[model samples]
Target chain A: MASGSARSCLEEAAALGSAPPVSYEESTMPPVDRSVVADLALFAGLGPAELDEVLREARSIRYPKDSAVFHQGAEADAFFVLLHGHLRVEKTTPQGQQIVVRYVSPGEIFGVAQALALKHYPATAVAAVDSIALCWPSAAWPRLTSKFPSLAANALQTVGSRLQDTQARVIEMSSEQVEQRVAHALLRLANQAGRKIETGVEIDFPISRQDVAEMTGTTLHTVSRILSAWEQRGLVEGGRQRIVLRDPHKLFALAEGRVPSERSGG
Target chain B: MASGSARSCLEEAAALGSAPPVSYEESTMPPVDRSVVADLALFAGLGPAELDEVLREARSIRYPKDSAVFHQGAEADAFFVLLHGHLRVEKTTPQGQQIVVRYVSPGEIFGVAQALALKHYPATAVAAVDSIALCWPSAAWPRLTSKFPSLAANALQTVGSRLQDTQARVIEMSSEQVEQRVAHALLRLANQAGRKIETGVEIDFPISRQDVAEMTGTTLHTVSRILSAWEQRGLVEGGRQRIVLRDPHKLFALAEGRVPSERSGG
Candidate 1:
């Protein structure tokens, strides 16, 4: 349903924008397909007419790899739904340290601070790879929610689940060791973006040791040392920017702070 | 509108329960006042009829200090709206470490895992003080949302803000030092639960140094040392189960990882 031509039009539009060197040619962009809209669980159970109404207001845009889709503190004029590729949401401290909050996968929504009545984006969203997203103006939300109550319901559910996940991450950071934290972070990422490979499950992204360190709240050297230890134990394979989880069960045991033998014996 | 007799009835009913030793008697409980429903921001836009509909299905109950309103992993049959006092949401790791996720102030909602369609509570909610809450069955959610869309919208907004706050906490834990983390944590608590005192603003709950240490992912010794250091500098005053922020500006500067003089100079 998503075409290269549509993406090209979006890129051209993004190019016209002064901020982020992106342009947005609204009139020249192609409308999102109804099938694509239907595929999103957020819009499930909506009638075809409602789906058409949504697509009428939707504009698909493409962002080049490593380019910011939106910056922190920018006005939340619109919200986005990822259609393809990955996005990393990050927040920067006053001292300029960037912290990766989480990654967005296809079919997930982001830039939704407006839905919460927030006037600005809470974090920056950057394209981890060349990515496509369907965007809707914040003003259109109330009408859309009234027309399709499921959209509001689904969005609420998504926000609720994310809150629980973030709280869990807080608990992990507060109580777990760095090694266990790294293991848990990898397991979560793998669950979200893993693809089966000859070795095991690859994360299917170009995530480096530094990125892992950021995610786990540890130093790069510590992440490198842990990965090296895991590689030696055949629990994971890492090279350059790629990581393959060779033994997820062992990693799970480590994340639970238990010896692999203890898990196996049990 | 919350009567002592109604609280007694609820307590008698809770006593009949097999789980937690808390008591409550539903039979003698007085119907919740519609005015009370109107007072909650979550139900702000609803008409009197809708408010009555909500009250018809609501039960107001009391929780004594240190009592658990619900346990982690318990069936999430109902969601609650705090009417008075405070509640602390906590999660226990597998290694038996309890992490304080967040605290719920009056007029806020908690035990809302059911709103996400989760079968069980993701965290335990305990009474940080003698608390009162109005509860509604999870099954009542759909009807409530459909009748009063603002309820769903408001709840979503609340969850969204909490998610952002939690992510901010994760960022702090990952990037800031323990001292900065402690300062930020106390400042946040002060914002939410601070009460004016003769010297400074006191956190309006009986929170211990151990609680602060758990919140900042540090040891009790570290928290004590930092608080003592701050006391010496006239930044904060601490006593048995109490903390009063003597110099919020200084704490704010510290939280930003800057000295007080630098902030004043800027």
Candidate 2:
């Protein structure tokens, strides 16, 4: 972990050993700044003192790039806020298939098993890049939210937003064919993490074709075949772990059924 | 509508027109009983006085069998709890295919647009049977939740539970074959609303092949064909909208991949 000021309240809590959930690697990390999460939707409506109180209960841990934060079926005893960087949340089905549930962006709260009334984490969370997270014991959820009504209100909004996203994905998967679903997934990704390039919006992150396949509920081979077809049509430029949409409108037309599917078959 | 006591506080609120969203049909209906919702999870932490306060804001309406309580794209200005009976919640895709999102039973909440931060209802909610719902204006959500933190806390659990349900469906839809997916869907429905028969458990409410198709993310033709095969194998009995699982364990084995799929060339 990066060096910081001094041993903070989190260290003191770890020494007390009241909760094993939030205690990560021992470090003399500086105390969290109230300003860090002040603007996040999770902390909205909180006063400065209230924010400070919540932050005091948090312990910071640095996750190296591509490291597993938690695994499926592990005891879900903590909740976290991404202080910086991205996380990939995936669920492995009993048949050993992996599905990308969602990617957590910075300022978002996740691993919230308490909200789900679940005793174990349903999916695995991994750091997509080197990341920092502020975590608190799941036991603190009820106490803090009870004392601060706004916390519960904010949590409701967060869970509600995620439910809506999941519903939308379900609808898309149920109603559309494979290529159209993939197109919709890509458009959504661009909307979420796009960077403006000279020609078109390029997805800024280094995301693999396997990630795309997982997101759209298809095999990697199918994704490769579709991307190749799109590349031939000059619709999207696909390289290793990179994708740039050269003609987003055309893809949208195909996805929305305004135009015929260009790929014959895989 | 059923007649009860004289016009009460809800009538007065409707007369004032402060919120038009919950101004249902005028009726001399008796006020809601505190005991009716006192044990409900939503009102779990509330005192009798607080429950009364929340109930006072609700306007009751009786929806006849097969009537719509609300439609997709309608202004989402109200939230509801089922006082009695069941509801079928569905969403139509851009391509006009309908998907059954869920079936809401008595004592459960629905149509809380405030929780989703949505301006309109995302799905159509129809009465699967003659139903009564007590609705509050969406404008009151923040106010009531602010005053009663447990309301927001309970709402979090509700939305989180739905998210997990949706996630489970997404995984099933992505990873499983049609017969297995349909089996899982039926097993879940039976678990939710089944009535014990001599040899099997029957889904108590009337449900159609189309509804099963919608729930399992398959075509109606596919569902019919699969059901016919199951009937022939003595696994289930289907007549009109009724279904009885003659050997639920066999279906469960198929769904969980404990046994090989029996349907061939459907």
Candidate 3:
């Protein structure tokens, strides 16, 4: 190596002292100890001492499938991070219509409303599958934010992103036809938590026809009828709780407002 | 004062070599500033130094009445805080149908699309009237957030609130009737940006009949017909670019999907 490169390497070594080499990926992995604060998105750049302080106050929990992790209007006193498995965010209208807001996968966060205003959960989050999560009480937020400003900033950006998504959804509901809305919802679900199979992508969740209808803001009868039609056309395959896209291109065509009958041959 | 207490105070002061004279207000101002940050719901619990940094970087601008700030799909780079006046957020469908998204007032934010995934503005924001605003560049976001974690956390919370609002709007559009929607929209506008005057609470913005119609996802003709009927009943005073509510309580009754003709009777 050139002398300049060697000098920089020596400086880096001096700065780090003599510690075992750690890769970036390794650092992202959840810490084994319950109280060892891992570098979260909000606290990514914090010093080790500060992280230790956070970790001391952090707790971990495991949630089984179909668990009611939290309910809407409950006092928000903690934030959660999904270490593994899935979480579903949903809301119910006064008319008793259940709407699926979105799904949270690993590395994403839930119960962020605790940090927001109203100090209550705005939506209900359920453990879609057995999940591991990290919890930090709201009391620690002020101290954590003070010690790690970058974390707070990143959190804002994430919230901003969610706001934009919500706005787009509003636009869709106001403007797009129901069929297009359904298409968009399916595309979003696939993007968020789909598993790639040899035939096509499958949304990795035990979603029912009613769940799909609620998500698309359509009737259960309508959803079942449409799915049955698509199944006949070989666009998708559904059996019991599983839904697999056999031909996404055809589904895309339907989403763009083309009649399923017209595209049957294709 | 007790003699022992006075003596102990003097001794402690003398020990510190002439303690600095402190004003109660001045001493508390820092935390008060922190509370103010918290009030913004986008900077809850921000440290004094970080807030000072944000205040230093903020730029103020004035928007003339009815001027378009950012159109949909314009490159997004900054988010704005309304210092004064009102703004109308709207979107146009592919078929050229205009839909009112929301009316923003003082102390609220606009152009938050910069915080989301879009590189472009998602909607059109028009100054409903003469407006003063503070702008924060997206470039400054990273630095501001990194320096002030609470600010970032608050930003996330703000986004969450927006998401919840949008979700509600979607639910309304998907299920509610046009007339009901019009009443709801009017009520929301009155609450958010209307001025309570002797005549009634007039929408504190230069909104047209067409604007109201679009907001409710109805035709201008239909809105005009509805208003004309309401006017004859002495429920409202409708003028070019102005509408005065003669009785807010009665208007609210109408908004609740009730036939309030008797309330507006002679």
Better of 1 and 3 by DockQ: 1
Docking quality class, candidate 3: acceptable
Can you write out model 3's per-residue Cα lDDT over B147-188, one digit (the tens) per residue?
655556656666667677777776666666666666677778
Task: Give every collision pair in model 3.
Answer: A42-A151, A149-B149, A152-B152, A156-B156
Task: Rank candidates by TM-score, best first.
Answer: 2, 1, 3
Return the lDDT, model 2, position B215.
94
Docking class of 1: medium
User: Which parts of model 1 have CA positions greater than 4 angstroms off?
Assistant: A1-30, A260-266, B1-30, B260-266
lDDT of 2 by residue, B1-266 (tens): 12223332244456646655543433434357787777888889888888898987787777777777777887887888988888889998877889999999888999987667889889988888788888888889989987888788888888888889999999988888899999999998888888899979998778999999999888889999999989998889999988999999899998997676563544
- Against the true structure, what is each candidate's TM-score? 0.88, 0.89, 0.76
Report residue A54 deviation for candidate 2 (angstroms).
1.6
Q: What are the DockQ scores of the candidates, in order?
A: 0.73, 0.71, 0.35
Error of 1 at A140 (Å): 1.3
Name the candidate, 1 or 3, with the larger lDDT value: 1
Model 3: lDDT equals 0.68
Q: Per-residue CA lDDT of candidate 2, range A149-235, in tens?
A: 877877777888888899999998888888998898889888777788998989877789899999988999999999898889899
Alpha-carbon interface RMSD for all candidates, in angstroms: 0.9, 1.1, 2.4
Q: Fnat of candidate 3, please?
A: 0.64
Give the range of the ten consecutive residues with the poorest summed lDDT in model 2 chain B.
B1-10
